[model samples]
Target: MAGVRVIVTLNFPSPEAAEQAVAGMAQAFKPVLQEPGALQYELFRSVDNPQRVILMEHWASRALYDQHWNKQMREQGAPDQEQARALSPTFEFYPQANYDLVDGIWQPLDPADRMTTIRWA
Candidate 1:
């Protein structure tokens, strides 16, 4: 089964709010890290934009990710729709067949995999 990666970007009104949100998220997700099929989960703050936060999550498979999501909704209740909209979060997903770690470097399993290249301006 291919691994699933989700990138979630959140925009806050201020740096203080972003920091608070990050702290809250870290606390809330502590148990999620222990959930089965949870491959990786990390939160990062944008250096250039203090009001921005990024959540990087990887699941062992799509089914596992869905199972986690369902469990969260069931346990925590569905998030308030209006409140969630106010946060203005964006999300993206990537499905990868395999990954490799060579010489402390992470890369796709297939040598010919055309990974996206980011060119910083």
Candidate 2:
């Protein structure tokens, strides 16, 4: 199965707020990085707009992604919309075939080959 990709954009009210939010989020990132099937999770700040932050995540499979969500629900419950709104976060998910890092480049799997699920650590 292709891994799941999640892209989240956070637009804060100000650069200071974004910086503070990033610092707060840093505390949460280590635990996530230690989770099973967490292929990659990274945060980036926009060079032109310091108030903008972007998160990129990859999971080994849809099942793992769902597991992560369930775990979050059990631990933190649903996120507070009011608190989330303060940061203006936009999230997007892609469930299609994933790419492989080959020779320092990302290479998409052949459509026919992608039907067979492959796991990457």
Candidate 3:
């Protein structure tokens, strides 16, 4: 079976700080991505979240990914994605959603189909 596309977002104090974090992250996930099920991991610093970062990852299967999250306790031997996530960071797992329903992949808003406000319900 295929896997899910997870967007892990983070924020920094300033643009300079974000840049530094991005660089640090580039080297941090080296060992992580090498692990099983960690198919692909990409880091992105958003224009909106100048002080923030995003991690787009793809896994071989949700089970393996879940194992990584549940068992990857640096407490045992693994590494924390990094030490920067302690700053009010959170994650949302939308197992039902992917880029298919969304038109543009990276750019969420398309000028041709832009809407003023969005309502979840």
Q: TM-score winner among the candidates?
A: 1
Worst 10 residues of 3 by lDDT: 107-116
What are the models' TM-scores? 0.77, 0.74, 0.59
Over 1-121, each residue of candidate 2 has an lDDT whose tens digit, in order, gives 5677989999989999989988988788889988998988888999999999998989988788789889999998998889889877898988757577778755567455454545454
Candidate no. 3 TM-score: 0.59
CA lDDT of every candidate? 0.83, 0.83, 0.66
Residue-by-residue lDDT tens digits, candidate 3, 1-121: 3465677777676789889878887986887798788878888877766787888888777787887777666436654566545545666554321223344343224342234223353
Clashing pairs in 2: 1-117
Residue 29 displacement in candidate 1 (angstroms): 3.6
Could you tell which candidate, 2 or 3, scores higher by lDDT? 2
Candidate 3: RMSD over Cα atoms? 9.4
Q: Of the candidates numbered 2 and 3, which has the greater TM-score value?
A: 2
Residue pairs with clashing backbones, model 3: 10-53, 11-52, 12-51
Cα misplacement distance, residue 49 of candidate 2 (Å) = 1.0
Q: Candidate 1, residue 17: CA error in Å?
A: 1.0
Query: Which digits, one per residue and each the tens of the lDDT, describe model 1 over residues 8-120?
Result: 99888899999998999999677988998898889999999999999999998878999999999999999888877877989898877666666676656655453542223
Error of 1 at 63 (Å): 0.5
